[model samples]
Target: MGVFGALNAAVSGLSAQAFALENISGNIANAATVGYKRLDTSFSDLVGGGKGAQPGQIAGTVSANSRATNGLQGDLQQSQVDTYMGINGGGYFVVQGKAGEVDGRTIFSGNDLYTRRGDFEVDKEGRLVNGAGYYLMGQPIDPVTKNVSGSVPQIITIDNSVIPAVTTDRIRYEGNLPTTPQTSNQLGGGDELLDATLTKASTGAAPDAAAAGQTVGVDAINAADEVAFLNTSIAGEAITVYNSSGTPVNVQMRWAKTFEDNGTQPDTWSLYYLSDSAATGANPKWTKVSDAQFDSSAGNGGQMLVPANDAMTITGLAVDGEVVGDMTLDFGTGALTQFSDSNGSAKISKLTQNGYPSGDLAGISISEAGRLVASYSNGRTRELHEISLVSFSGEAWLERVDGGAFEVTPESGEPIAGAQGRIVGKRLESSNTDIADEFSKLIVTQQAYSANTRIVSSGDQMLQEAINMIR
Candidate 1:
């Protein structure tokens, strides 16, 4: 019975060694697999049941258990693809498997799976899928609301549809309006100088020609008056604004120093825009838009006073048979300033408009916040969806699935929703398996397996001796 027990123990040793070897081989084989977690074999001794188990009399059967190093973080490798994403810390990307096609739509199996693999590519249907054929799930962002919709994550689909044109609604202008402007004589005199100093009067009336200092109303300035005072009083600024049909129209604007206070009152300038038929008709040639009043004591020395009601609106705009709605021009507090400078040129530091022409989907990229941003041919970017990351309390206990994915098990707690780790775009996570460590384990497994075989042979010899004695 002792010899038989010894033979059984040796057999158990060989089986345990074989199990360890299997895990070692698997680890070495998947050393280059992306986001692969290494498997390790744990050995435990099985003692025979007895009242007082002696050292040599006890059965020593060994059992091997497989454990996963799922908690280990992999090395991040830079990828050229813009959609390639990697997790830097502890977390996994929530993914779902495709069940089948239903009514020409790919249906998900509803089984939630977690993985670190992020090698995703857009399929023919514009759905983002990983190498393992799992679809990436995320929360869709509402374009109008600019908020992520829904608490539950759904399969993320890229919208390749063409974006329609949007009419210009608002124009933000920021720059320095020159106090003094260099102008040219539009009259017959090719090189004649005109007085540049602006004079003011008590009431809105025509300036006295003979009076040394006089005030002239901006509305009273006609085409001939504009030409006469072009060099001295007014400066023009023009920009192209888009209409509803995406047609660009040149909007010419003129600023005239209507009222100037020597030291007491605030200086004021009247704004005007050139009419469409101004070149052929209209004596004044331009229509007044608003008045920009500068109070020296208002803000940081002096600043333009924006109407308390709202920004100034330009209405009744028509360009090339296309009618455009009113646009608001807002000069933020302290944005427009009056300072003494040699150049009277109005410099536009920043000018932007919230309008774009019709465009096609150009490309897609992953943002730092894990949102998928789509770029259009019209030079616009829109956030389509926000990727959600899930974390588990028992990550190591997750069941290993195909393609480096893991399934939820009883030991793995429920996934906590939301972002769990910092997202890195245009990168991929490499396998956690270390080749050098695997090779070392491989050597030990090989030696251990050989030593177990010798044990079996030694047990066979001992059994043979017992059998020979019986003979």
Candidate 2:
């Protein structure tokens, strides 16, 4: 029984070493795999049940079990693909296996899976799938609301459909209005004064007689009058805005300094926009939209002025006989200013309009905030979805699934739904397996297996000696 027990012990040792080798081989094999977690083998002794067992007696067998190093993080690898993503700290990407279709819609198996793998590519059906054939899941975002719509996450599908045109609704302008402008009469000759609204002096070389006589009131200035005045003003800017049909409409705007009331009020300037037809009309023209007043002493005592009300709604916009909807123009406080400068020209610091024409899908990208933004050919971007992450209390206890993914187990605890790590786009997580470490373990396992075989050979020799004594 003693010799037999020694033989059993050697056999168990051999089995334990073989199990360790298996883990080492697997780690070496998946060393280059993305998001691959290395497995570690642990050995325990199975003690004999005999009550008479002595302390020095070999009455125990070795047993081996594998535990995954799933908690270990892998190195981040940079990739050129825009959809590729990586997690910086902790957590896994929530995913699900594709399970056929229902009602002509792609359905996923009820089992929810998580993984560190992010090598996702858009398939023919416009669904993002990784190499392990798992579908990515995310929360849909409403473009209008700019918020995530649902509580539960669903499989993300790319929408490649063309986006319809959107008419201009709001325009924001930020810049400095010139305090002084070059007089129109200073340009060419007095003949040009015939087309202008200003009343010229008897002498052709003299400046505007009416402007010098009295101050122009905001109520007295009409669209046609402003257009005639801006034709020769030196302080103006032009920008191309889009219409409902995505057609480019040139909007020319100008500013003209008006007479200050009692010389105590703030400096005022009339704002104008050129009509669509007048843009290329025989003479360039404009229409007054509003008057901008600047008080340098207003708002934090800064050089900029805060208008009493800065929003102006422009209506009755016609482009080629097509009437566009009204657009609100916002000149944020401090956005528009009257500052002294040598150039005496209005400098547009910022000008943006919230409108885009119909556009084809150009590309897609993932942001650091886990948002999937789609870019359009018309130079517009829209957020489509927000990628979510799942974490576990016992991450190592997660059941290993095919494709380097894991499923929740009783030991792994419930999946925590929220963002757990910093998301990095255009990157991937490399496998945690180290080839050098795996090879070193392989050598140790080989030596231990060989030593166990020697022990078995010695045990057999002892058994033969005992049998010979009986003979």
Candidate 3:
């Protein structure tokens, strides 16, 4: 029984070393794999006595198990691909595998798995899939409110279809209006600052009818008046606005100084836009948009006077016969001033509108905030999805599966939100396996296995000698 016991212990030692060697081999094999977590061998003695060792008892046999290194993070490598991502801290990307296809559409496995691998690319069916054939999951974002629409995560699909057109609802205008504009009329030695017959100068009434109508005209019949009108007004930067059906129309603006403060009335200016490019013979060419009131006696000489009523709404504004619905011309607070310019023009530093023509999807990328953003050919970007991340209390206890992913186990706690990790875009996480450490373990395991084999041989020889003595 002692010889057999010695042989049994030797065999168990050999088995334990073999198990450690297997783990080392696997670790070395996956050293270059992305997001691979290496397993370490853990040995335990399986003694016969539970409380304490008996007198003269032999060393117990060995049992081996695997230890996980899931909590250890890998180094991040930047990639040129826009969709690739990496985690900076503790979390896993929630992903699902592809089960099959039905009618040219991919069907998911319906099983939620966790992984650190982020080498993902957009597939032909518009699904964002990793190299391991797992689909990324996220929640759709509302385009209007710019918020996640759902709480549960679903497989993310990139829609390449043309984005619908958004009509112009607001135009942000910011610049300094010239205090003394160098209009053609002013440069050409005009004795009068403004020609009241041509321009609708404010008449000091609360709602002057003439100030609200026919600010300027460019009709062919009054071709000479058109030239005079152009000479009197200073040109403003032109901007393109989109209509409901994605039709673009150019809106050219002009600013005309209507009245200077004569101690009785405040200094006023009328803004007009080209309404008809092809109008001839007694037809309206330029239409009035807004009447800007300024405080000429203020410290800065042309600070805007009205704060509460600064913005002007252009109702049913038509440019070249394209009817654009009511849109607000937002002159931001303290944004408009009457500073002197060397060129004597409205230095429009920022003049942009909130409208875009229909466009096709140009590209997609992951953002640092874990948002899947899609950019369009029309120079517009929209938030499509919010990437989902989860963490487990016992992450190392997760069951390993194919493709370096993990499944929930009895020892591993359920996945929870609010991980301590942040998403890094355009980067990939390398495997955590170290080749040098594996090689060192390989040498020790080889030596241990060899020693166990010698013990087994000695035990066999002792048994043979006992048999010979009996004979």
Model 1 ranges off by over 4 Å: 53-59, 102-104, 184-238, 250-254, 263-265, 272-288, 296-301, 305-310, 319-322
TM per prediction? 0.84, 0.84, 0.88
The parts of candidate 3 lying over 4 Å away from their true place are 1-4, 48-56, 188-192, 195-223, 279-283, 306-308, 460-471
Q: List the residue pairs that clash in candidate 1.
A: 201-215
RMSD of 3: 4.0
lDDT of candidate 1 over 1-471, digit per residue (tens): 676777788788888888988988898898878788888999999887575647544656889999888888889999999888999888889899999998888988999899999999888889889988999989999999979999998889999999988888887766666553444542334322233322222123554342224243344334444555455444556767777777776667666665564566566666667654344322444555666666656344556764544367877665434566788876665676555546655666766777778889999899988899999998889999998898888888999888888999889989988545888999898888888988888888888888878877888898789789988
- Model 2 residue 180 lDDT? 51
How does residue 107 of candidate 3 score in lDDT?
89
Off by over 4 Å in 2: 52-59, 101-106, 183-231, 258-268, 276-284, 293-308, 319-322
What are the lDDT figures for the candidates, one per model? 0.74, 0.76, 0.83
- lDDT (Cα, tens digit) per residue for candidate 2, span 1-471: 777787898999999999999999999889989999999999999886566648654567899999889889999999999889999888999899988887777778977899999998888777788889998889999989999998898889889999998888788988876555444643444322113354322112343233343444232233334445654454567766778788877676766665442345556566766564534423323445765666644353223342466677787665435566688888886677777656757788888888778999898899868898999999989899999888899999999989999988999998898746888999999999988888889999999999999989999899889889988
Candidate 1, after superposition: displacement of residue 195 in Å? 7.8
Candidate topping lDDT: 3
